[model samples]
Target chain A: MPATSSKPRLGVFKFASCDGCQLSLLDAEDELLAIAGQVEICFFPEASSRMLPGPYDVALVEGSITTAHDAERIQQVRRDAKFLMTIGACATAGGIQALRNWGNTAEFVRGVYARPEYIRTLEKSTAIADHVRVDFELRGCPVNHHQLVEVLAALVAGRRPRTPGHAVCLDCKRAGTVCITVARGQPCLGPVTQAGCGAICPAYDRGCFGCHGPARQCNCESLVGHLVQLGHDANDLLPLVRNFNGAAPEFRTVSDRLEQGWPEAGGPPPERIPT
Target chain B: MTDTRTVRVEILSRVEGEGALHIETRQGRLERVELQIYEPPRLFESLLRGRPLEETPDITARICGICPVAYQMTAVHALERALGVQITPEIRRLRRLLYCGEWIESHALHIHLLHAPDFLGYDSGLAMAADHPQEVNRGLRLKKHGNQLLEVLGGRAIHPINVAVGGFYRAPRREALQRLIPDFEWGLQAAIEATRWVATLRFPDYCRDYHFVALRHPDEYPFNEGRVASSRGEAIDIDDYERRFAEVHVPHSTALHSETRPDGGCYHVGPLARIALNRDRLLEPARRLADELRFETPCGNPYRSIVARGLELVQAYAEALDILRDYRDFQPHRIPYGHREGTGCAATEAPRGLIFHRYQITADGLIEFAKIVPPTSQNQKQIEDDLRDWLPGVLDRPDAELARRAEELVRNYDPCISCSTHFLKVHRHDH
Candidate 1:
């Protein structure tokens, strides 16, 4: 880590993803003015035309590595920053674009572009950690703005950020939301998905689609069995686990198992379940 | 005087996605002008194949986080059209309200954070905040109100989960919506002041005799449904989009350049097009503000889009307030529909411009094929054309100033390059 200084120099970088995670910083309307007063936003291209040279104090990187140029660019970013954090599903795990990893990338290219030969892309989309060491990883399709603010605040204050590692089920129970799965026989992912989104879907009476990645020690097999009992087959479970955070280790293992004809012996249990 | 020079901006800043501009001049004559979209393709169309049709709304929304609602709205509208499902009036109103939230959020962002810096002689909005804190604060608050609206109706602000194929999983309570009224009221005033403020900025004296295109509805300003119409007296059904408009691949850029099929010419889309096409349909405060700002119809200057976006922000707030005030309890949250094998197409007014989606599904509700045409791809050719036309006036200026001006030209469209490269619709040429 770089030596501590009076005001932390912040850097925001992007690779191959939607510009949403960085946008969350701007989306924090009230908090942004206060935050801007504290940190030197040295290199955020999406918000400013001016760029400051970096040996940045804290680097928040977004997007997955999907091209040869970006694959090399991320290493340089890592070398320049003292504390590097990966934000959103695209950076922590491959985003929805990672669905191409299982299939043929050439065919995938041909399906979208009229001139596939002109397009340059990697065969698979992988996260920033696959290429570099990450200090912390924040999860979400587009990360929660409040959590993003918390992380930045912690960095400025020289304290550990307080982010929960529990399942969406905990948030649902706390919010007193009727479990869509038990109450209406809907196939919900709340038991396996992470909780940063405040259990919004369950409160809205819909199944959690797992925008956040898998929670700590998520029991996806038991949840799959529950979904199957709710009349959904392996075909349904495959898409659910393989969505935004599909390429994440836990979620990918479950999805791959379902695709391989649902073996009686599934993958190993998660390392630790949230108490 | 004969001269040779190359002006290149390797990484154009303050835009949605990664892109660059390369211009080469020989003896004051423009030799090459290429707007290079280096954003890697995401292959959304290929991923849609074999997936259930119900998943389209959620899957496609990931195309661009800045405008996920646009992607979700277009997908559901097309899918509903295919399934022969007509949503209830209440559901329609709610969808419109959701769109208003997006417009406010997106427009406020562009006006204050992205585009405003160019006029203010600042490198970024953060830099400008030092001198104009009050204006910046107002813009942020306006944007916050928009986010609040999205959270109330759709769930979370970015990539909302409440929207599905037929309709929302659950409609918001009237009381919940009413809670947002005071903020919306403040937002309307802020947007109006924003329009007035931008009107004072010095716009370059440049206008192009171009084709302006957008979705035109018979009743209200088009948001979800309308006929694909252009200013050159050409109007066609949304189904004829593929035949009338086509995207061609250029060697230098990953994003395909779009054009009108018959003449192979470029057309302008987005805020300027929307306001020019449907000016009369704008509601009270926005209409009155536009009048005070002296916004004449057929605004051909691309730089004035800031004013147009600000006016739309005001209109969006007014429309949202109207919907919320008239909202009633006990409205059905969603209308159920069964899926069948068919083709459907729809075009909606995204904050940037018109976004169209077409899908063909199999008998069991599997997506056979999908095509998404975002606003940025449609504006790509127009941006290059603008550069070609506007370069002559500033050819003698310093390269840095010229390049900065070129970036501002591109920002006028507020291009979202991520949305453009997600679906390319590559055509196979049989040898």
Candidate 2:
């Protein structure tokens, strides 16, 4: 019945990260069937066996481009979809696996696998946008499922989805969560991190780990400087600033300086952090 | 004419991660089988190097979205072992409650959405949902209750952030957990009925011999801790896991295939294996459900695994209710610890199967090395072995039908290919 339907076709694809982001759509248990009714889920192998050849209406790509094969495959995905959206930190900023970009990828494979020769991977894990033009990018280590629903609905309605670009501090302020960085002297990146994940870490009585990459106009260096003045070590700042969004421009620029020398002043952040 | 044929499933659907199957037959003889996992490797073990020990739970939880609690629980246990730490009894109960939440979520998803379609002759659960709205909605509702438990206790469902090396970063208040009792009380019955509903589906007569393996604990159905036990009669301490099992890289897949050490043979994990090994330890209601279904111990049919997963759903829901109803918040939410350079290993029963983890940490709490043997990797070789045995029986069917049957057999494992370095995409070659 879905084959003959003219509903906007949605294709979900993955590359080099955990399947969490795509699962967010499924995790939206209340809205999944309703969304499926509106969007003909024509090409998500994770959910359906039917794999219709696509000139799809919407394509949601998860994970980073980390293999030679994936590097080429994404070009086809971009060509097939009218609107392509990258979901999760891996798609937008290379995810936690971006940690490998700092060192030797060959060594990384060798460290994990006994037969490194059997493994074939690129020198770096990079975001989907590095290889193809993306219409939208949803940021999170796993992404907020509620935002995912909003985006799917927006794309169908031909409207811009209202995703917050401000820092998570805004969310904490709205929720009235006490500041862990101030109240408990905990190292926090909420001031510089994006507003997703509903600002849960502080309410859990721990410092923010920055699951949702860098916020719009993130002042990463300024926040790091404040923490350093508060007696947190270089180690603390490096881990906080260079985490799931470690490869995002603001965080990466600040981390690169911290790697060179933190607590001591460094030069300005670069205009961009290339994937 | 002597028939020669080949079938390739280019992308396997209804499972986590990317994988495909390649099958070959020459003159009526099954020649080759490959459960190829093409999901790009993320290098989690290598990336974990030099990270703080406390971060292990959060970091390792990224291995699979469907089973992140398995990774988190295994990581925290292993990290605690490395640090020579002891968690309070209250914290231990909380960890079990968290795991129960995951089992409910992961298993409910697999049993109803991922695995049930095969029995009902549908391409997807959404397709099945068209005629079975009540059933599908009930399943998703049950799954959400699990997510709620995770949200209240572990901070969120996917990659829960509350788990730490010694214990939770914050113990959930008694009231927070108590609120879940009503839902869990309802879910326990829902899961029990769900098990009965799934048990009615006509299962193929596909019983075959298996060296079933899972964790075995004395007091309970194994979750957080246990000896690695096998239906083949091998039981060893979790520390001796590597001595018994080892992983090897194959040319066709990014996920490494694991084999029993020395013997170098495939072994099974997941619900079927776990049930075979630990049926006696299941809670009273679940054990009774198992008996009511007339499911004997060591059920060797892979197709009936949907029922097996249903049984565990009942077990998880019932156990979670017990914990939530008796909930209490405690002091020292995290145990303080001193670390000396040390190594540790732990095994926990994920919703899918038994997952093993080992780590070496520096005196300063930075991880020196980490090894995670997710359940799917342990079952990869076993799935391949099953296909070799299963393909012959379906050879009389048309090429497309054969491939569909083959894919159903693979799906019976509820394989979490994402966790393995891990689906079936099919091409048919005839000669």
Candidate 3:
């Protein structure tokens, strides 16, 4: 990756999620000009109208796979990409739209469109890695700008990008903020949530809603007990666990148990292993 | 003289979503024109079922990245109506400011990155930048300012987590807003110049008596709050959006075609519709610039939509400055919403056009049903009409030229096929 040996070719691919993750790249103000100079920017339709054929050096895939065509398309992207990275919660653990995975997708389709015959979609919205091997996955509802920049820079440097996989509680501790759960008895997903959003909810004098998906080794059972103690009922817990990263294994396990009318204090047989 | 070859223009190079222009003519007679949208439908409405009403803003914001704020605003507004809640005046004003940021950012992206290259005869903004580096830089600078505005108010530009159903998760500090005054001043100058520069482009001479529909406010240009109005003497409240304009499902697109109640044809929204309807409400500097440049109000040509977008950018900057001048501290109040059963509809003028959202909430605060008609779908029919009118005049031009112009016309609308969520191509046996 010499600076003078022509710029690295870049391609942006979208699947089933909202266009927010790709929009994050264009939203980069200071780094955009510098990055534009360093990369060929071969294909990014959201920003530029120009495109080029690719055996690309880096392919940043946004969204998840939600259709038959998209399921096939991810394989082609895998073949073309030298290094592929999935950005945002949708591409990582499935987006909030992944709520379809828990219910009847057929009925969901009929509920939305007047003519279901016209709509071509799969039964579930799945992450990109479910189909193809993703070189890296950035976790966030839409992803943090600093992490986005750092990942792109690391890709150029041919190294694993540094993104925090720790719980939001660590960031809250670092920021020296009081615990909303302990002090105000607010049910927060912060203990199980990723830390990229800068503990924004806690900073804003509210509880974290887990837009960044789940952290590694999240204790969903313990978190649920805390939420229950905080005066949250079944109705509150249902939406809480099923947020941006609702489909992630840990969150989904707890949510599914709750939805099936499991006891809050002690669930039956611990509900088929923790995520 | 049957020239049965299909003029397939796969113009997926610019903007959000995937769409292409398919035109078929046999023996010099136009047989079919289809604006095909190939973007996959995510079924936002279906997924919203069973989710809590509070998550509506955060979830719906995912509809379109370019105008996430618009989605947030419309979703929250609808939720408020269903929950029997009313946001404070200060919160409402702040919402307008946030929308202005979206207008500036989205419009700047279209005018500079997508549409400008077509006007300047370049393949892309990168190509255009080779000759007009300063212009490109200024557009970026202005776009940056808009993103900064969102950062201050909503905490981040795309999929902002700060805003919720009733009000913001946290109110922006005055010092944070005050810091943006310098950038606003600079963007104001840059946008004014950009508008003048865009005005210099050669526009296609075309006009139509469109049923121009928009949200009209009494005191200001429409943003988050306004009454729905049309050029054909139709005005109504937000709740009556479904009654006033009906969406008809066309086979050509997954996105529905919207028209006046009586017919399913074409109408206009976005810059031309707004400037046409609210010319008197343009801010002082924008109004002065319009007079200084002799830029006529209510421009009809679709090509001039680029110019109208540029003007809106200037107005957004001016409005942001005015808002910052009178900024107040965060109000201490919980977002008041109660469980109620109702059907709520809202239409906000997104940077592109009228973005309509309709929702039916159950008694227990669950979303029973949802419908969203983005600006791109609304303009799909009108785009086909423009092609019908402009194609005949420019058909004899080089295929490359015709293709380029055709793509430019589509980009002029800044259509987000992802938001529209459905379009298709037809290969007819007759053609």
Candidate 4:
């Protein structure tokens, strides 16, 4: 939906992730004043106390639904927002805290809090899309500032956001960076993860750990097979895929396959003598 | 006949966590003041058990989004200790520069956004900004420089990936660092002015004889390294942190309250503590500004903490410039250290106060036990003490004035309750 009014009313909402993504918005210090001037910033509790009741024009929602209150809140936000964009891994796919979704919630809760009886939470931490509709998703552990600005501009101008839906391998290639996986035998996640963080890990002479979630065309099977060929066994690949973007469909599928002990999708496990 | 009253203050404003103050009054006198932390308990230690040692830096950084670098530094220091790795001089300089970014950013955040509102009598920063745009803009610009430096060096401002166990995964180029110097020079001037501006605020003349505790380095205002020291004649190395401080669990709140070990009394941390303990170590401009403002040593007044934070911002800017001037390029280090089975005790100044992290690692480099004491948790008892002392005089004031002043008192510490643990539970005295 286009902002028919003079300025778009922006609202930033948080639910269950580490508040890093929202901090990114504030981190846009040079551009922040200009951005504030361009929009009506109706509700951003983290930044402002003067919240104008919304019917917000656009909502840049961070975090995931982890509690009964959050479930209700997300629904209310969706109703209030004309166009709701989920920001970061937590809003699209549950965050690192979503590791709880795989474990027992009651036990996890008991292990964490002293007054367990006072705590109120759900069994699983799920994304905003799991409950209400998310018009678009910005992928990353902490969404890139430049990309965030682009997304906001697009929403204001009534144009589809030009956020790269491409993979990290493409970014690495464009930056003229040599593959750590190919050269140094690092088990990089570049092949399956999204592009936004400018292939930072690879440029640093280390393998990409996939802080940005899975891209649109992730072929995790081939990547996993290649990593195994390079050196990593099932044990290494399990955790590699299960990090920041662990819950995304493509990565999760490959992780599940590795755990289930499937014999290389056809033939027996490749035998290699230890050094 | 014995008279008793329990005053409960829920959801303390101008601080970070969910905490309440419960004071028990018996026989027309103050009995017990327990600062209760009700923030949802996060088992960072327990969660870290099975995870690999390399993942500790990023995992621990999640403890506080605002001061992620503090977490990163402490975690990396502990890991380096466990792994038997020593970072090079160049790496140490870069680490200090990164830490200065956090200090500038975090201090600007508290002094301008969270703490300033209380001094100016506003609900929040945005409201205060509307009334005083230029002042707010100046703060934002100073904060911008800090963010810019962090982004250029650490890759991202929060939970930066550039820092690792041995050292930074990537060393920032000299050119990138040089580009920051001009803006930082401007920020230094602005920060000095900001210190003066903050000092001008009508600071409520309320002082306490707090046993201020902070990391004190002989040559510098402690950022990355220091020996823990206090106003009340207590100094110890990082290893003796647990011996000096003790954490106790109260029946009212889930979060534990920390105090001096033998005496078991509350002590304060953060700017007031840091500034008071390291007064002589402050940089030239900071020292000059402190003198001009007449912010003498042993500053126990909690309200002057904002002024102290502003002064620290100036010190941070100077430190940043010093690092920039002494810039040198170095090859990235990746010397893997052998992990040992032992406990690591470390304390670094987080933006809010002294953040202590102690972890027991297994031989295989996995965390067996983890205990973190954030600044806000440490200040709980001291906060209640301030309320108990001040409330008697203000009990006759209108409810609105009393509540406002109470909130202002809490704001003095610039408490990042979100980082530490918050509902302000005030146990007021009955006339």
Candidate 5:
């Protein structure tokens, strides 16, 4: 059915993902009804049965491009969308599934499927921006519900979404959480990960594992050095850096460097990790 | 009139993940039904190899967002069994409490937002909220309470990071868990009211004998522990799950269809199954309210799964409050375990239904093999069977109306395609 409303049309798109990030919009328990009141939710199939034909005013794309059909499908989404925003680690970064980028995708298929011939997938799961021009990107393994609501509210209000690009350390500082890394020699990713999760892990007295992906100025070299001094090996640090944000450029470079050991004189590594 | 018609719904909405349904009717007789799950496979098992055992729960939690804690719970229990670790009693309570949070969140979302629209003739929960504002507001409040509980315990609702192999990463303070008491108390009564409200909806005349399967515990309503029990009196241990049940790839769906190991027959799992197998075990007032509503045992109608979800929601909130009131400070939040080469398996009740996870770990604690049979995969063949039985009665309707009804039938299961596609494969016997 055509949405005969004058309000701005919002379209939610998915690629290959857990559906957690887009769910953040629904997880906005208090704001969801109010959100429905404001914007005409024109094409969110997860929340609505309505697949209103869109020249969508704003499109929030979740997941990452992993299949040939979805790859072409995204181009159509880009064409139909006036303004596009990529949400969550899968769209902003390539998600944990992007770990397939390092391994043989064919082998990955063969291992899981009885007849690998039937399954069709791309060699790698790449970020949405890698495929098309994205006006904005929100980062999280699952984007924070509050941030999701803010982005939707901003899009409706015709303003830039005010999601800060600071590291999780800033959030930890604001919450007055004692740095687990400094106190207990834990290998915390808070110094490099983006802030939006409100430093929840450290607040629970655990090390941040970078679910929110990379912050603007992630000094991976320095963070790695500090962890090494704290009696953690490269093996301990590699998994932390590579996971979730493994395909993000900043985390990817450091992970590559970690995989290839450092020089005797404490210099950068000699080679890429060969993705 | 067209004797041969195919009602194809390319995209099923108001459900988790992605799927399409195709139904065929020939001469007013139901011919075939295919629930095509075109959601791209992530191949999590293939990728899981060589990852450390510690990461299993966290990594598998990404399979589905709505039921992340279900994946995590099954993973941790399976992995812990592999490593020969025993958890403290306190850890067990916390784990159960965390699961209650997921049940409330997942069930509440499905009932109010996804499934209720089918009963009331609305396209979306957002659209339904227009006239039924009070009901919608109650749903939101109920959903938020679940999220709040998750935040206090598991860290965040979607894919919480706190759950580890043997236990949680950190034990929450008694004060922290106690804070949600007021909301939970209100939520239990609210859930009962919700159940009462949904019970009033007029149900379609569709009921048939189903081989309802669920986890059955001797003492409690099963969550993390039980032997698999069915309405046909079949009971088996979790380790024997693969021996009794198996998955076969259909050409159409990215998700494999599950069937009985020997018979290749469809069986049902999820809310209705759980209720059929374990309704007597439910704590009051959820149990008492079931009597009040005159809820049937072994309810064959899948559409009435919403009532079962509502009852479960009441049970979740009631149980959650019980745990919250009893919770006190506990020591050794994460139990210590050393690496050894062994294989272990577990079955747990996801909000959707029963899920199974098995693992073989290296002596060094890296995963050697991993297998996950999520609830939706297990339910797919059964869904197809239901539609085959269902399509004939509604065959006279035009394709558009047929598509609408078919989509409603699929939503009854609340299928999560993302989880089902993770370990799917084709087994074309006649090829």
Candidate 6:
């Protein structure tokens, strides 16, 4: 929706992320100056040092809630903004870091840090929606810059953004690229994955890794069946879907189903599957 | 009167990731200086285990958006080394071209948007844009050219998808590479002017005897391959990286501070280090521009790193142009390879500094173990040391002013707290 005020106050917040989605704002290179002209950039620490007191007109939040501080801090952000949108995989679905949600986070801490006791984090890495209400969720590993600009522009103009909710298969068809799954027998998530990435992986002769989250009304079961037909076992399908957007509800359901009943007899389960 | 004071910055601005600074003084003498990074840990190393080896390039790239190419390059090189896949000369050149795009994009962003505002006495680049519109536009244009180069080669500017273990999944056509030539040529000229422009900034009169460390290659300015070398006469292969350096956990910060072993002394890295060590290897216009700017080696003023970053930007553009000029078909983008169970190590010069990656792969191509040492972690100790030595000189300044200057000093290193902390949580302790 269009802003009530002439120059809408904008704030950008980070929780726990790679800083890619935030960088997309800067990556909007030419449009950045013009965007700054249109809105009041109140709180973007990655881009500016000048910070205005909040109760912002809009807030573009990145990253997932990983720490106790973040869990509490996000509530204050929601209180401060009139409209709050979660950007990228980390915020929309717990990011690739959300892979820890399936395993023991304490073990992950011990494995990576020399002194695990010094690090304080929640047992599960979770999406922003888990802690607070999110107005809209913009999906992508690092969101598409053009889509980011469009979302901001739409919000400023008092209209809904025109981002697509279709699958990567639609974008692949639109681009007239040969399907990697059909030709190379690659285990692709294009049929169920979202389209914002412009079908990039398929265009490059590789399978879609689902950097964009699951598309609206995705038929993941059908796609997994197709992969099985293409000579992939239940085991291969598990890791393929459990990647950047693995923690998303639809992807998680499929991955869990594929991983049911393992470690038969005494032999070790699969060599490469994460516990 | 016995006087004491404390300076604290809750969160630093204009740098990647979350970090803070706290300084304490007792009786007008500096007591402590801490560069605290509180970025939440994502546990990339632990999560990487059990993933397929080929998936590494894409997975590790998520560690930092600003330098995903660095992570991808390091991972691919390490995996290929273990797999015994010898990439073609053409592939090597292509990798260098892709890296050039990253360096150009990263350096331009840092020089203009992040660092320049500090030197110009503006609160932010947006404030500076009101006065220096032309300069800001030029910087953006240069940055856009770099992004364009990445788009053409890697399919996206941030978190590129084209890079694979042996080589790219697919190569760009000659026409695609040619399209960037015009913009790169313009960028090359603009980059030279940027170097000269940054040189004119009034830097504070401060110098330190830094033990600079960076990757050094015999034939070229280091990008993909080199020996780990430092100014204190220490040189070692990439495999010996764990032996010479170690990460120490501090109570104040989530990011582990890296120190040179034995005595646990700090060492400097990044643009300043790269330029100091590999100045002679700079190609054409960058070499001539460096000479004209009088950017002498053994230069220790951290604030002057903006100038070094600009000069490197020039090198990136020149290198990109050179690679495109020698473009060939080189059919079959990537070489075929089989999985092996062995450990492999590789170090590459990220825009910031040297980033090292080591991995042990299983016979089935799964990543059995993974270790990554990003440039920011390696520089964390040096940042604290710089603050300690530099704080004593400015102790008489007001608390707010001291905090501002301390933040600027940290920004000078262009530290990526996101890369360092892997996980960060800010805890404010005022004494």
Model 3, B239-280: lDDT tens digits are: 787776777766656676777677766888889888888888
Cα RMSD for candidates in order: 4.2, 2.8, 2.9, 4.5, 3.6, 3.9
Every model: iRMSD: 1.0, 1.2, 1.8, 3.4, 0.9, 0.9
Per-residue lDDT value at B180 in model 6: 77
When summed lDDT is taken over every stretch of 10 residues in candidate 4 chain B, the lowest stretch is B1-10
Off by over 4 Å in 2: A2-4, A265-275, B1-4, B427-431
Error of 2 at A248 (Å): 0.7
Model 4: runs farther than 4 Å from truth? A1-7, A104-120, A259-275, B1-42, B121-124, B127-131, B250-254, B395-405, B421-431
Error of 3 at B240 (Å): 2.7
What tens digits encode model 1's per-residue C-alpha lDDT throughout A85-172? 9999999999999999999999999998888889899999999999999999999988999999999999999999999999999999
Location of the lowest summed lDDT over 10 successive residues in candidate 2 chain B? B422-431
Candidate 3 deviant stretches above 4 angstroms? A1-5, A264-275, B422-430
**Residue B163 lDDT, candidate 1, scale 0-100:** 91
Off by over 4 Å in 1: A1-6, A263-275, B1-4, B422-431
**Whole-model Cα lDDT of every candidate shown, in order:** 0.87, 0.87, 0.80, 0.77, 0.87, 0.87
Tens digit of per-residue lDDT, candidate 6, span A200-263: 8889888898899999998776677666655687776777888888899999987887777222
lDDT of 1 by residue, B1-431 (tens): 33645556667788888888867676576766778888888899998998889889889988888899999999999999998888888888899999999999999999999999999899888788889888888998999888999999999789988898878988899999999998888888888988899999999888888799999988898899888889997788899888989988887787888899888899999999999999998998899999988998889999999999999999999999999888887556777877688999999999989999999998888999999999999999999888888887887887778888888988999999888874111111111
Q: Candidate 5 at residue B330, lDDT?
A: 84
DockQ of 5: 0.77
Give residue B325's lDDT in candidate 1 (0 to 100). Answer: 88
**Candidate 4 residues B1-431, lDDT tens each?**
32434444444644544455555555555555555654444445555666677787777776666788988888888767766678888888888999999999888877887788877877667567778989888998888788888888887777787878888887888999999999999999999988988888887778888888999998988987889997877689888888889876555665556888898898998888898899899999889889999997888788888888999999999999999988978875555678788777678888888888877788977777667787877887788778878766655555456555776787777665545631356655443
Tell the DockQ for candidate 4: 0.29
- For TM-score, the strongest prediction is 2
Report the lDDT tens digits of candidate 5 across residue range B397-424.
Answer: 7778877887888788888888898521
Expressed as tens digits, the lDDT of each residue in B1-431 for candidate 6 is 34644455667999999987766666777776677778888899989988888889999999999999999999999999999999998999999999999999999999999999999998777778899998888999998888888888998999999999999999999988987788888889999988899899999998889989999998999999989989888678888888998888887777877889888999998999998888999998998998898887968999999999998999999999999988977777899998879899899999999898999999988999998989998898888888888877877777778778888888998889888874111222334
